[model samples]
Structures are given as C-alpha cells and as structure tokens.
Target: MKEVKAFAPATVANVACGFDILGFAVDSPGDEIEMKLVDKPGIVIKDITGDEGRLSRDPRDNTATVSVYQFLERIGAEKAGIEVVLHKKMPFGSGLGSSSASTVAGAFAVNALFDNPLTTEELLPFAMEGERVACGAAHADNVAPALYGGFVLVRSYDPLDVVRLNVPEELCCAVVHPHIEVSTKDARNILRGEIPLVDAVRQWGNVGGLIAGLEQENYDLIGRSLQDVIVEPIRSMLIPGFDEVKRAAIYAGSMGTAISGSGPSVFSLCRGMDKAERIAKAKVEAFKSIGIESDMFVSKVNKVGPKIIY
Candidate 1:
C-alpha cells in the first residue's frame, strides 16, 4: 500500500483507584493520521490541524511523527521516505489521552501501510515512546486502551504485560473538560513520591475490588470500589471547582467521578445515557458557576480500538 489513514479513540487513564495501571477508551474526540510514501528519505511531517500550531512539526519533537519514525526504524525501513499529516480532534493537556490517540493513529496507520507487521500488543511500546516524549514518562494506561480498546489493565510493566478487562454494556461515561491547561509534566511533579502505609493499603484494596467488580459485572461494586485515596486527594486540588463538580455529579446519579488523566478534565461513570447526560450537565454547570467554561462528552465505552479509515 502506498498510503493509509487511521483513527484512534481517546482514553481515560487512571480510572479512579488503579493509578498508572487502568484505563478505558471513549468513542468520539479522537485523532486521525494519514501517511503517504514520499520520494525523499526519512519521515517528514506534512501538516497538522485542530492543534492551533501548539504541537511541533519536527519529527523529533512531535509524538505522532516520532512514533511513525520509530515504527520505520523497527522494521529496518528508516530510509523509507514517508510524509505524515495529523488531525487533533481533542484539546492538548486536557488529560484525555490526546497525545496517545495521535501516536496510536500514526503507528497504526503506518503499520497498515506495511500490511500489519506488528500485533496490537507489539505496537504498545512504540506508542509509549511517543507518550514519554510528551509526558516525560513512559505510561501504558492511556496508550494501551487507545490501541486495544475497552478497559485495560497494565498489570505489569517489567515485561510490558497488559490485560483487556470486561466492561458492562450498560456502563457509560461522562467527561467535562474545563477551559484550562494542565500539563502532564506539571501534574506529575505535584505528586508526592511516597504515601503513608495506611493510605497504600486502602488504595490496594480498592484497586483489587475494582478489578473484581469489572470481572463480576457488578455495577454497585464497581462504584463503591472506585475510591482513590492517593492521587485524587492531591491532584483534585489543581482543578478549579473540583469538589463542587464531583459533588454535583454524584448528586446527579453518577456512580463515581475523578480527574481524567492529569486534569482540567473530570470523568464520571453512570449506568445509562440518561444519568450520564445529567452528570455531564451538572459537572459543566458546576464549572460554569466557578467562572470556568467547559466542554462535556457523554459516551459509551468504545469497544473497537484504532482502525484504518482509508
């Protein structure tokens, strides 16, 4: 194939209790990448859209371009000339796995052009490399779900192990992105390196319960288990009107709510679209009351991952 285009869905990382380990894909507000063979050697970024020129065009600095470059190098095709174009449908630094969507789209598209040399799992590391360039750390929570879809658990990073967890069909997600920028780097920096043993034990129990809830398809268990005593207490402070917004979501019938990825965006899980819509409106209104403009998305869990668009 001489050219290919693909779309990758946005992801919600952390998923409350399972920090750095759990995530799930959402339908809508993703990234698209198009790649075509070129006569010139090496990878070149031809164009970008919806990013307000905030993202770098240089291959070395851009996540999508860097991922495509790495894929070429892995296949011993570094000298193969290719041009890439990216369309960012989501806001950067909004904690919705914006960079991961782009990286996965680029890598997935380029791999399609080569008739698929790597499996979805195999494409993960390259995607994480792109994530590292953007966030200053190699994390699989966002990239894994964006690549594989549904709910994912990064059980172990030592051997790069990942598991696709079952998600109940009735479960829905509502997210609100406040008009504020919170860099992933800044969010990570604010986290304390160590937590008390008491908090650690509480966190461990909740994560285990969350996994069990997902496996058992028990919505109540999942909601009760979605407590985050470690990350949320600290990171929620960075988001304006976080407490009020979360309270509103819960009062509006959301199962549980937490900061999405690094923040400025918050997500809640609900049983159906009706509750999800109410939660979204409540969350948005709470932000507005605080003089913060926001955007809300209510969507079902995306079962399909990245796909070739053309």
Candidate 2:
C-alpha cells in the first residue's frame, strides 16, 4: 500500500502505586495518523488537526512525525520520503496520554505502510523517542500500554523490558479531566526527591498487591492496592478538590481513585460500566462544586492497542 492510517487509544499512566511503571489503555478519545509514502526522501508533516495549531509541524519537534522519523532512521530508511498527517482527538495536557496516542499512531501507521518491518513491541523504542521529543523524559508507561494495549508493566527500563499484565473482564475505568492545565514538568518538580523507608515498603507492597489483584481478578484487592504513598501526596495538591473527588468516586461505588498521571485528571476503577459512569458523574460533580469544569470518560479496559485504519 502506498498509504496507511492508524489509531491509538489514550492510556492511564502510573495506575496509582506503580508510578512510571504501570499503565492501561481506554477505548475512546484517541489519536489518528495518516502516512503516505512519497518520493521526496524526507519526512514531512503535511497537516495536523484537533490540536488548534498548538503542535509543531516540524518532523523533529512533533511527537507524531518524530516517531515516524525515528522509526525510519532506525531502519536505515531515512532516505525514504514519507508524509504524515496527525489527528489529535484528545485534549493535550489532560494526563490522558495524549502524546503517547499520537506517537503510537504515527509509528504504527508508518510501520504498517512499510510492510511491518518491526513488530508492535519492536516499535516501542521509536515511540519512546517521540515522547522524549515531547517531554524531556522518555517514559514508557503511557506509550507501552497505548502500543501494546490492555495493561503493561514496565518491569525494567535498562534493557527496556515491558510485560503485558492480565486485565479483569469486569474492571472498568472512569476518568475525569478537570478543565485546567497541569504542567507535567511542574507537577513532577513538586514531588519529593526521597521518601522514608517505611513509605517505600508500603509502596512496594501496594504495587505487588495490585499486580496480584489484576492477575487473580480480585476487585477488592485491587481497591486496597490503589494507594500511593510517594507521588500522589505531593502532586495531588496541584489539583483542586482532589480529595473531594476521590471521596465522591468511592461513594459512587468506585473501587479506588487516584490522580491519572501527574494532575488535573483523576481515574477510578469500578466493577462495571454502570459503576464507572456513576463514578465519572460523581467526580465531575465534585469538580463542579469547586467551580471547575471537567470532561469525563467511562470505559472498560481497551484490549486492542493500535489498529490499522487503512
């Protein structure tokens, strides 16, 4: 095929206790990328939509094009020309893995168009490079799930070992994005450089419990494991009504609630779609009580990561 299009779903990074390590994808609100092979011998970003002109068209700067560029360079196909068009369906800085979705879409589309020189997991390094271009750090929590789908655990980053985890069928996600911007850099800067050993022990247990809960399909254990002792306490202060929102979600039958990635967006695990929707509404109302507008999404875990659209 001369051209191809792909879509990648938004992801929830961190997943509470597994900071910078765990993530899962959601069904709605994703990014799309269209890539067309050309004779120009260079990557060109022809268009970007739904970004409100905020995204860079330069291939080196934009996540979508940069991902494609990196993939081609890695494959020694830098001399091959490609044109990319990105559709940012989701909001930026929403802590919903916006850049990851775009980056995955671009990388997936180009790889498919090129007849799959790399496997889905093999495309991860290029996608991570795209993230590094977007932010200063190359984090795989968001990109891993967005590319691999379902739940993923970044077991180690040295050799870049990522493991896809089991997802409970009844587990649902409710995400609420308050209509406020949370700078990822600023949110990260506010975190404690070091924590007490007691907190570290608690966090390690919670992470282990979360993994077991997911594998065993134990919702109650999952609820108990959603506590964050290290990052949430500090970063949550940036999000207004965070405590109230969490309380509201739990009251609305949510298993647990935590800040999605950095701030502004909060996520909860629920038993089913009904509970997920209720939690979403409750979180929205909680934000409303604080005079903050918000956007909400309720979805079962997305098992399919990225799809070829054309």
lDDT of 2: 0.92
Best by TM-score: 2
Which residue runs does candidate 2 get wrong by more than 4 Å? none
**Model 1 off-target regions past 4 Å?**
none
Cα lDDT tens digits for candidate 2, 1-310: 8999899999999999999999999997899998899999998899999999999888899998788888887788889988888888998888999999999998899899889999888899999988998888899999999999999999999999999999999999999999998988898888888899999999999999999999999999999999999999898888989999999999999888999887679999989998899899999999999999999998999999999987
Quickly count the clashes in candidate 2: 0
Q: What residue pairs clash in candidate 2, if any at all?
A: none
> How far in Å is the alpha carbon of 145 misplaced in model 2?
0.3
Global Cα lDDT for candidate 1: 0.92
Q: What is the lDDT of residue 162 in candidate 2?
A: 100
Report the Cα RMSD per candidate.
1.1, 1.0
How do all models score by TM-score? 0.97, 0.98
